[model samples]
Every structure is written in structure tokens, then in C-alpha cells.
Target: MNLDTLKQLDLDDREISIYMTLFRLGPASIRDIAGQTGVNRGTTYEILKRLAARGIVSYFPKGKRRVFRAEDPERLLQLAEEKQNALKHTIEQLKTDIIPGLHHLKPDFSSGNVSFYEGDDGIELVLKDILATVAHQPEKSYSVFSSKSLRQHLYRPFPNYTTQRIRQKISVKVIALGEGGEDAEYSERKWIRTQGQPDASYIAIYPPKVAMISLASENYPVATVIDSVEIATAQKVIFDTLWQLL
Candidate 1:
């Protein structure tokens, strides 16, 4: 019906255009089909050949010209069923192989690496990372929150990370800039605040592992996390010194 509909079957733009044109135009030669679809003759022919091999199209010779016709639309349903069965078989095979295979798989996280994500997706990543660390070790987890620029999405939906942290009995230490604390009503009962300097940014301290240094840019968030135990303790020390002054 539409390019989007065809794409669900994994047909790209050209394939979809050609196939849909054939469906609308009835039996026609490759050249006519291409003209009707606004696709080149060669590409239309190739797509039709692929479609024919899938048994959703058929071709027959009529005089000197070849005509192509779409199979009944019910074939689309059958194709989807075939895919479902194949995925089930593959998943069953994966169950047999995944355990031993996983033992051999090693994820390489560079000592400190940089990853870039845009918009709300980026914020979600930061939220997940922070919450997991908090739940893992609540008492030792601390956050120094500042909102240099994070007003637009301050109240947006974050994936139930806070609830998870609370359920795990993670103790959170929140240190906010003076106005930063006033801006949002954070549920973390253990919190500290300071006023002034709205552009100073936010810092998160998680014990034994990661510390996230996030800047609250109004449009997006930018943060660098240091996960080395050595680095995390050094950060905790800095936070302690700051906490004492507050």
C-alpha cells in the first residue's frame, strides 16, 4: 500500500516502488512497469525477478513482450508466517549454542572510552548507567547534580530507574547547586545543595566503579564518566571535601 508497508517485508524503496506499481498497473512489460513506477528499466527488472523468486509475482510471455503480475495478497501473510517459523528455529538453535559461545565472548570496554548519543536517547543512557550503579551499592553512591542547561527535559519520562534504585535500597547522596535543588523536587531523600553558578554542571559519584560528569546543556546532555576504582575514590574524596564545605 505504501513504501512503509512494503518496508515491513524488508523491501527497499526501489523494490517497493516496482512491486506496488505492478500491483496497481496489472500485467505489464518491464519497460512499462518501470515508466509507471518512475524506476529505471534495469532496476525494475531486477526487483521483479527477485519478487518472482519469492513466489509473490509471476511472469508469462505474451507475444514479444513479457507481462508480470502480482500473486494473491494472501502470499504476504504466508511469507510472514515463514519468517516467524524461521526465527523460532533460529532462537531454539541459539539456546543450545549461546551459553558456551558467551563464555568465549569478551566485551572490550576501553579503560575510558567516549560514546556519543543524541537527544532523549542520550539522556536515557546516562539515567540507566547512574541508576544501575546506585542500586548496586546505594550507601556508597553519591550524585552532585547541577543544571547548567537541562530544563527542557527535566521532567521527561526516564525509564523507571529511580524506582529500581529505591527497590534495591540504594542510598543516594545528592549534592545540588543552590538553584539546582530548587528547580526540581528529586525523590532521593539523601540530598545536599549549594546555590549560585548555574553553569557549573553536574557530577555523579558511584563507589568502586563509575563517576559521571554531566553538563546540563538545555538541548542535550554531555558527560564523561570515569569508572576506574582509583578514579572513583579520588572523585569521592573531592565530593567529600565539597560536601563538608556545604
Candidate 2:
């Protein structure tokens, strides 16, 4: 019998081996099962005790000695069902108890908030937050200062970000700082000619927040999210002024 699926029930390799050996050999003493499975007698007896407690194995007295054997394999399906029901209960508890308690611990946004995130996964989180913010707002638009170098860094980790944004119908007005970005479906591009290489960074201005992202090749990718209405409004004004000039 294929016993690989037994691991899902949290059985270790030795326990699985001993159980299968018992299943094959019928009722057997610990010494016999241990020798067949190559596990020591003491450990095999402990494993059998655990399996018996879980109803996966049963023990009966053979004279003065106890003989152990596997229960029906159908017990595995019952164990899986129990695990699934437990997961559903945990989800319900989180929704009803845990999340509400967490919401009460949120910090005040009026004092201004700054969050630092590092690595590619951290950058994706910031991008996802931006998308979520725009998705909830009525305006459905945001502004970006798109650096060519930054895009090169970002495309590798988030190739489908733009596609997902377009699919959500969130529009962006972009001020391209270097070369070679085409207008996408939900975006408008305005170019700013630079004398030399532009700084390797991107700025995203959205409602009540602004995000600054660094695309430095010397280190891991990083992003900073500033949650302040005053700062975001000022950045939006500056972007608009440059948008008109370019």
C-alpha cells in the first residue's frame, strides 16, 4: 500500500514504516514489528502507543504480551476530515474574534506614518497596497514619476503588475524620467528629458499617501510608504506642475 499520504496526518517516517509493517504482518509483538521495520523496540512501542491513542492502531493481549496491529486504512480519511473541519473552525474564529481585536490596535494616522519595506516581496506588498488604495477611491487615478532604471528592476519581480492594474481599471498619469516606456491601456505617459542618467528611483503619488522606491543594484530593492495627507497633497501638486510643463 502507498503510505505517502500518511505524512499529512503528521506521522513521522518511522511511525509510518512500523504501522505498515503491522498492517502487513497482522497482530505482532513490538520486537517482531521493530525488527521488520528496522526501528528499535523501545521507539516502536512508543509509536504504537501514540497510534493506538489516535485510533490508527489497536492492541490486544496475546497471553501476557500485547500484540498491536493497524486499524482500517479508512481511518486516514476520517483524520483528514477532522483536520479540514479544524481549519474551518480556525478561520471562523479569526473572522469573529481575532481580526476585530487586531483592528482595535491600529495606530492613529493623523500623526503621520512611515513604513519601510525591503526585498522584492516587500516591494510587491507596497505595490499591492497602492492598487488597493486606488481601488477603494472614487477618483480611480494616481500619479507616478517612472524612472527607466527602476522599471528595469521592477519588471523582473512584478512582470504582471501593470496588467493587473489595467484589468482593475485603475489609471495612472506617468512622468517618464528616462527613455523607452510606451503608453499602456490604463495609463498616460509624459516624458521629461534628462541631461544624463536619471536617478534610479520611482515615486508614486496617491490619495493620502506617497511611496518612494529605490532601484539600486548594489543592494536589495527597498520602498518607503509615507501615510500623510499633507505630504501626499504637496507631492500631487508638484507632479501636476511638472506634468503640464512636460
Candidate 3:
């Protein structure tokens, strides 16, 4: 009998052992359950009471003695459902109460807040954040400084990022620092002439945030996101200035 499921329902070792013993033995006396599970009679009796309270174990009078039995195995599903419902209610409470309360404790900073992420998954997170942040903006658009060297690695983590952006009706303006980039729906691209290999950095300017993605090592990516209205607006101004020149 797999007891892992029972363990998740908050059953301790002794309680689970006694419960399983009753389940297998069928209508056993307290003394018999204690012996089978190697728990003392006093502890065994308490565990049975706890399980009975949970509606998983019950007792009936067998002559002068009470015999305990496990409820149908299907009752475990009911326990899981109860846990799920309780979690749902807790999540609602957190959103309305706990989260806002915790936010109040956070330090208020005007600017220079930065977060870092590493590897392909991290790059994907940066890309997703860009889309999500831009999608909610009044104009639903953002600006990018794209480099040819980092462009291939940038989308490896999220190859369908463009598709998702177009689906959301979010547009992007790209100032390409090197050779190649594709034009797509809801996007505008401009190229810059450069000597030697272009710098391997991609910068995105979305209001209230700017995300920069680059290589920490060959084929290994890292991203840093800056959260500040002043910095993002400055970057946006610079990008637009360069955009007009090109």
C-alpha cells in the first residue's frame, strides 16, 4: 500500500502506521492495532481519535470492545479536495490582506533598484516582463536597442516571443546597432552602420523599467532589470533621439 498520499494529508509516522494497520486488518481492536503498528496502546488510541476526527477512521462496538476500521480509500480524495479549497481561500485572503500589508513594509526608493537573472530561463523572464509591462501601458509600445551579436541568443529562450507580442497587439521600435533583424507586425526596425563586431548587448526601454540582456560567457546569458521611472524615461529619450537621427 502506498502511504505517501496519506503522509501528505498530515499523518505522522505512528498515525499512518496505525491507520494502515486498521485498514489492512479490518475492524481490529485497539490492542491489536498497537501491536501491529508497534505503537503503545495509549498513543495508538490517540492517533485513532485524531483519524476519527478527520472522518478517515471510525469505531464500532464489537461485544464489550470498540474495533476501529479505515474509511473507504476514496476518502483520501475528499481530504485532498478539502486541502485545495482551503488553499484557494488562503490565496484570496493573501491578495486582499497579507500582500498589501507586506508591501507597506517595503522601503520606498525613488530610483536605482535593479534585479538580476541568469541563464536562458532568466532571459525568457526578462522578455516576458517586457511584453507584460508594455502591454499595460497607455500606448502599448516599447523601445529596444538590439545588437546583431546578442540577437540570436536573446530569442533562443523565447523563440515565439514575437508571435506573442503581435498577439497582444504590443508594438516595439528597434534601433539595430549591427547587421540583421527581422521586421514583423506591430514593430518598426532601423539599422545603424558599425565597424567590427557589434557590442553583445540588448537594451529594452519600457516605462518604469528597462531590461538589459547580454552574455556572461559564451552561449550563457544574463539579464539585469532596472525599475525606475526616471532612468527608463531617460533611456527612452536617448533611444528616440538616436531613432530620429537614423
Candidate 4:
């Protein structure tokens, strides 16, 4: 048997080969197991020792020769359970120690970090994080929309989103570029529109944070965000300027 399934259980190449060889050959001497698996004798011995301690294998003496046998295939499922529990426990412990520092990273723009999100779940989490940080503040949010205007855009949900925010007394000022030039989601609000200022960009201001989504389809974006107070203040100024003229 190939080691494909066993590798995910944190088994090294030699360990996997040794385990599979025992399962296939059954109750064999270490010398024979090593020969069939093409694993060196030293590595095979070490892994076999570990496997025996884990209760996945047993060694017994028949007259003078030592014979090793696999415990059961059920041991693999047990190993998977052990891994899951260990990983979850470790993650919980790490949350208090490692995650706070992780969240505290300075978003130094020059450092060049990029995250590629694949599905709706990924995009939702990104937007959710933005909303979570900005929700408590009573400041206006500025946004630039792109594919938002295309036939399959997020037009319907956006208007409701704005109205809900307005009901919550949070003002939203948007400069819709290409698609921002399209129809309104709610008729009561007049949108300040701007388009084609050399580069295609979508801008958003959420109090002390600002984000811009750009140049991609519903599946992805060439986007950026800034959480600096000074930068956000400057964006708010630029947004206010256009809010006046447009």
C-alpha cells in the first residue's frame, strides 16, 4: 500500500513505509520488513519502536526469532482522534499567547504582504473583520465600488446594507467609480459619484481605517487597506472634498 493516507497522520516516509510493510507482510521479522519496504535498517528500527509504544504494533518472540505484528487498522482512526484533540488543545493555548501578537502586527504598507482569498467564506471573513472593528464608531464610511455595477454585482445587498447603517445613524459617503456610476439601491439617498481618474480604484473609509477594492472579478481583487489615523484622516479629507463637488 502507498503511504498517501498515512502521511497526513504526521508519519514520516520511513514510518509510513514500515507501517505499510507490516500491514501487508504480517507478523514479520524486522529484517524482512525493512527489505520489503526499501527503508534502511536503522530508520526502520526507530520508527518500529515508536509505533510499538503507540500501541499500533506488537513484537513477540517465537523460539529464537522476534516477530512483529500490526495491532489493527482501527489504530489509524485512533491516531486521527489523538491528532484532532492535541491540535485543538494546542490552538486554544496558543490563542492567549500567540494570537494577540498576531493581531497586533503593524500594517506597514512597504512590507508587502498579500493574502489571496478564494471563496465567499474567505471574502465574508475579510469584510466581517472590517465591520467588527468599525461598527462601534459613529463616523461615516467612504467606499468606491467596481464590479458592484456589473449585471451579477452585489447591488441588491449593498442598498440594504447602507440603509441599515443609516438607520443605525452611521453616515456613508461613497465615490462609485465605474459601476458606482450605475443605478441606486435605495431611491432616498443621493450618491456622490466619481469615475475614471486615471486608475481604477475603489475606496472605503471606516473611521480610523480605510480600504480600497480594485481590478478584479467577484472571485478576487487587487485591493488594499490602511489603518493609520493620519492616512485615514487624509482620506476623509479627500472624501469630503469630492463629497462637496460631486
Candidate 5:
């Protein structure tokens, strides 16, 4: 049996070793299991107690010594089912209790928030945050200042972002700074005449937050997220003004 899978159930290396040793030796005392597994007797006894609590091992009296053995392998399936149920309950509790409580703790405009991120992975996180925020809002439309260079950098890491956004029924209005992006199911795009392909920077204006991503330097992609209703409102006004001329 591949013992690596047992690690997913929170078993440590010593626990796995002792359990496998008992499975092989059948109803053996702690001293025999410890000897076979090369672990000290005290630690082996502790692991046996934990496995018994997990219902994967059991013990019986063999004279003055206690004999430990692995329970039926089928017991592993039962344990997995229990873990699944526990995870499901946890998700429900978060949705009903935890998330709402956290939202209530959000800071107002008197105290604005600023966050910085670096590299491709950080950019992807910003994009996902945009999607998640839009998903929960009453008005799901956002405006964007898009650039060809920035799109190329992000598409490699998040190829399915547009698809996911469309699936969520989120909509975007974009002013493509240079050229080479197309309108998708839930998006509208207008192009601005530029001398050449514009430098790689992206600005997204979603109410209460504005995200700026710079991918102009291939080796040093970075992003900044600002949470302020005032800043977002100003950016939205500017985008709308430029959007009308194009």
C-alpha cells in the first residue's frame, strides 16, 4: 500500500512507519513495532495511541503486554468519508457565519488601504481579487484602461480569466490603449489611437478600489491595490471622459 496517501489524513512519518510495521507484524507489542520501524519505544507508543484514536488501529491484551494491530484496511474509507463531512460543515459555517463577520470589520474611507504585490503570481492574485469583489456586488460592471503589453503578460498566467469572468456574468468597459484585444461575451472595448503599442500598464476601476498593474519591464512585473472610494470615483470619472471621445 502507498503510505504517502495516509499523510493527507494528517499522519506524520513516525505514525506511518509504526502503523505499517504493525500491519506487517500482526498483533505485535510496542517493543517489536519500535524495533522493526527503527523508532524509540516511547514515541512508537504515542503514535499507536493516536492511530487508535483515528480508528485505524486497535489493541488487545496479550498476557502483561499489549498487542497492537492495524484495523481492517476498509476502515480507511470510513475515515475519508468522515473527513469529507467535516470539510463540508466547515464550508457552510464560513459562508453563514465567518465571512459576514469579517465583512463587518471592513475599514471605511476615513482609513484607506494600500497593498503592493510583485511578480506574475502577485498579478494573478490581484486579478482574482477583482473578480471576487465584482462577484459580490450589486453593480457588476467595471472599467479598464487596457494595454497590449499588459494583456500579453497576464494571459500566459491566467488564460481562463476572461472565460471565468463571463461565466460569473461580470461585465467590463475597456479603452484599449494600443491595439490587439477583442471584445468578449460580457465586455465592450474601444481603441485609442497611439503612436505605437503603448507601454505595459493596466488600470482597473471597480468601485471602492482601483488596481494598477505594471508589466512594462519583463523581469519586474508589479501591482498596487488601493482601497478608497474617493480615488476610485476620480478614476472612473476620467475613464468615462476619455471613453466618450473614442
Candidate 6:
């Protein structure tokens, strides 16, 4: 049987092995399960006890030793449901209590918070932050200043970025530095004339934050996020002014 699904219930490799062995051996001793599964008797006994605690296994006295039996397979489904409910409660608690508590530990951003990141993975974090920040805003919109050279590498880490933004009903106003941007849902674009392809860089002005991404040597990506109302407002004003001129 495909027993991999048991892992979702937090069963480790040895626990699953011991449980499956019980299913096959029909109420076996620790020695019997250990011999079949190649796990030592001590580890197998420990795993059986863990599974028993989870209601996935049970045992009865058989003279000198205990004969452990696999509980009904349906117990696995019940365990999964219990975990799901626990996770939902945890998320609610995080929203109501844990997140606010954690925020108290954050450093002051009054002097302008700046963070740097490198590589595609780092860029993806910035993109996700954009979506998350904009989604909560009353206006649900942000602005961008993007260069043509940087456009191709920008979304490598997050190919579905536009799709997610559209799904969230977030809108964007973009100022294309050197042309070649696509029309996308909930987005408006304007262009700035340039003599040649400018150095590859992108600026995302989401209120209280601005993310700047650029390509380094060998087309590697580097990014910085600035978190401060003053910095973001200044950037937004410049973008708006340039946007109107364009």
C-alpha cells in the first residue's frame, strides 16, 4: 500500500515502517516488527508507542509480551483533520495575538529602514511583499519605474506575479524607462524616451515601502527594500511627476 500519506499526519520514516509492518504481520511483537522492518527492537518499540499515542496503533497483552496491532486506517484521516483544525486555530491566533506581539520586537523604522537582498530568491520576497502590502491598502494600488533591460530578469523568481496581482485585484501604474513592457490586467503603463537601454534597474513604490531591484554581473539579481513613509512618499512624488510629464 502507498503509505506515504501517513507522513502528513507527522509520522516519521521509522514510525510508518513499524506501522506498516504491523499491518502485514497481524498483531506482532516488537521483535517481530523489528525483524521485518530492519529497525532495531528498541527504536521499533519507541515508534510503536508513538503511533499508539496518536491512535494509529493499539496493543494487547499476549502472555509475556505485548502484541501491537495497527489501528483502523481511518484513524490516519482523523489525525489529518485534527491537524488541519489545529493549523486554522493557529493562524487565527497569529493574526489576533502573535503578529502584534512580534511587531513589538521590530526595530524602529523612523530613520528609514533599508534592507538588501541578492539573487532570484531574494527578489521573489520583495515581489511577495509588494502583493501583501498592496492587498491590505484601501486603494490597493502601487507604482513602478522599470527599465527594459531589467524587465526580462525581474519575474524569473515569480513568474505568476502579475497573475497573483490581478487575482488580488491590485492595480499598478508603471513608467517604462526604455520600452517593451506588456499590457496586463489592472495595470497602466507610460514610457520615458531614452537614447539607449539604461542600466537594468526596477523601482517599486508601494506606500511605506519601496523595493529597488537591479541586475548585477552575469545577469544576477540584487534588490533593496526601503521602509519609511518619507522615502516612499518622495519616490512616489517623483514617479507621479515624471508620469504626468510622460
Please list the residue runs of candidate 5 whose C-alpha ends up more than 4 Å from where it truly belongs after superposition: 109-112, 138-141, 166-169, 216-219, 237-245
lDDT of each: 0.66, 0.87, 0.89, 0.63, 0.88, 0.91
Off by over 4 Å in 3: 1-53, 60-67, 72-85, 110-112, 131-141, 158-170, 184-186, 240-246
When sorted by TM-score, best at the front, the candidate numbers are 6, 5, 2, 3, 1, 4
lDDT-superior candidate, 2 or 4: 2
Of the candidates shown, which would achieve the greatest TM-score relative to the real structure? 6
* Residue 224, model 2: Cα distance from true site in angstroms: 3.2
TM-score of each candidate structure, all chains considered together? 0.57, 0.68, 0.66, 0.57, 0.84, 0.91
Give the Cα-based TM-score of candidate 4 against the true structure. Answer: 0.57
Clashing pairs in 3: none
Over 4 Å off in model 2, which ranges? Answer: 1-5, 109-115, 120-145, 158-176, 182-197, 203-211, 217-219, 225-246
- Residue-by-residue lDDT tens digits, candidate 1, 1-246: 255866767778887777778778898899899888888888788899999998888999999988999889899888888888999989887767875586447343454344444456666776677776666463535655545445335324474655666665555555655443432223442244435445645566675555344444554655566555676778788877776766
Give the Å error, residue 108, model 5: 1.6
Clashing pairs in 6: none
Q: Please give the distance, in angstroms, between residue 79's alpha carbon in candidate 4 and its true position after superposition.
A: 1.5
Give the 10-residue window scoring lowest on summed lDDT in candidate 1.
182-191
Q: Give one clash count per candidate, in the order shown.
A: 4, 0, 0, 0, 0, 0
lDDT of 6 by residue, 111-181 (tens): 43788989999999999999999998999999999999998899999999999999999999999898799
Query: Which pairs clash in model 1?
Result: 138-171, 177-194, 178-194, 178-195
Q: Alpha-carbon error at 185 in model 1, in Å?
A: 10
Q: Per-residue lDDT tens digits of candidate 4, residues 1-246? A: 565878778777777778878888989987899899887777778888998988888999988977899998898899999999999998987777777777578465543343443233444444554556566665434444333333233322233444555554544444554333434442222353445443444456665666655446553444455566777788778767766776
Please, what are the lDDT tens digits per residue for candidate 5 over residues 1-246? 688998888888888888788878989999999899999999889889999999999999989999998999898889888899999999999999998898779766443488998887888898899999888899898999988877777656678999999999999999988878976999999998799777888899998899998864544778889988899999999999988988
Q: Give model 3's TM-score versus the native structure.
A: 0.66
lDDT-better candidate, 4 vs 6? 6
